[model samples]
Target: MIDILYFAWLRERIGHGRERLETTAPTVAALVEELRARDERHALAFADIAALRVAVDQELTDFDAPLKGAREVAFFPPMTGG
Candidate 1:
């Protein structure tokens, strides 16, 4: 099982902050596809992949990042500075 965390509007849209699930996805993008298939809330939250940033095990990574042995994955909007 892997811990999936959603932040900011993602959390709001998904109606929760985190979840733990077992998956056979090999990469973050594949995991996203699985999430999008789970429910409307998950689909909506991941609708725009370009608007999101991802982190694996607390380290920022791209959508194609491998999930082998990963324990946590986080999704959030890109940080902006004024």
Candidate 2:
């Protein structure tokens, strides 16, 4: 099972803080596709990939990054340091 977390507008759109999913996806992109296919909420949440930032196991990564052995994935906007 993989733990998927949502932040900011993503959480608001999906109406979920997090979810634990059993998936057969090999990459983050694939996982995203699977999630997006689940429902309208997920589709809306992932509609703009450019507006999303992903973290795998708490480390920032690309959507094409491999998901092997990853326990957690988080989706959020780019963090602005001021």
Candidate 3:
């Protein structure tokens, strides 16, 4: 199983902060597609991937990043300087 973490508005929209689940996705994008199929909350949280940033194993990466052997994934909006 892989741990998925949501931050900021993502967490608010999904109604939770994190989850652990087994998946057959080969890449982050594929995992997103699977999540979007789960329910309205997931779909809404993932509706605009362009507005989000992803981290695989705590390292920032593109959505096309491979998920092989990955233990965790995190999603959040891009950080901006104040």
Candidate 4:
């Protein structure tokens, strides 16, 4: 299982901050597709991939990144400078 975390508005939209998912997804993008297919909340949260930033094992990564042995994945809006 992998831990999937959602931050800020993503969390609000999904109605949960985190979840442990058991998936056979090969990449971040595939993982997202799996989640999106689960419910409307997930679909809406991932509606705009361009507006989202992803992290794998706490390190920033792209949606195409491989997820062979990743333990954690997080999604959130792109950071803005103060």
Query: Each model's TM-score, in the order given?
Result: 0.99, 0.96, 0.99, 0.98
Q: Model-by-model lDDT, in order?
A: 0.99, 0.95, 0.99, 0.97
The best candidate in terms of lDDT: 1
Minimal lDDT window, size 10, model 4: 14-23
Across residues 1-82, which tens digit of lDDT does each residue of candidate 2 receive? 9999999999999998999999989999999999999999999899888889999999999999999999999999888999
Model 3 residue 35 CA deviation in Å: 0.4
- List model 1 lDDT by residue over 1-82, tens digit each: 9999999999999999999999999999999999999999999999999999999999999999999999999999999999
Deviating ranges (above 4 Å) for candidate 2: none
Model 1 quality (TM-score): 0.99
Candidate 2 TM-score, C-alpha based: 0.96
- Runs of candidate 1 with Cα error greater than 4 angstroms are none
Report how far residue 47 has shifted in candidate 2, in Å: 0.6
List, residue by residue over 1-82, the lDDT tens digit for candidate 3.
Answer: 9999999999999999999999989999999999999999999999999999999999999999999999999999999999
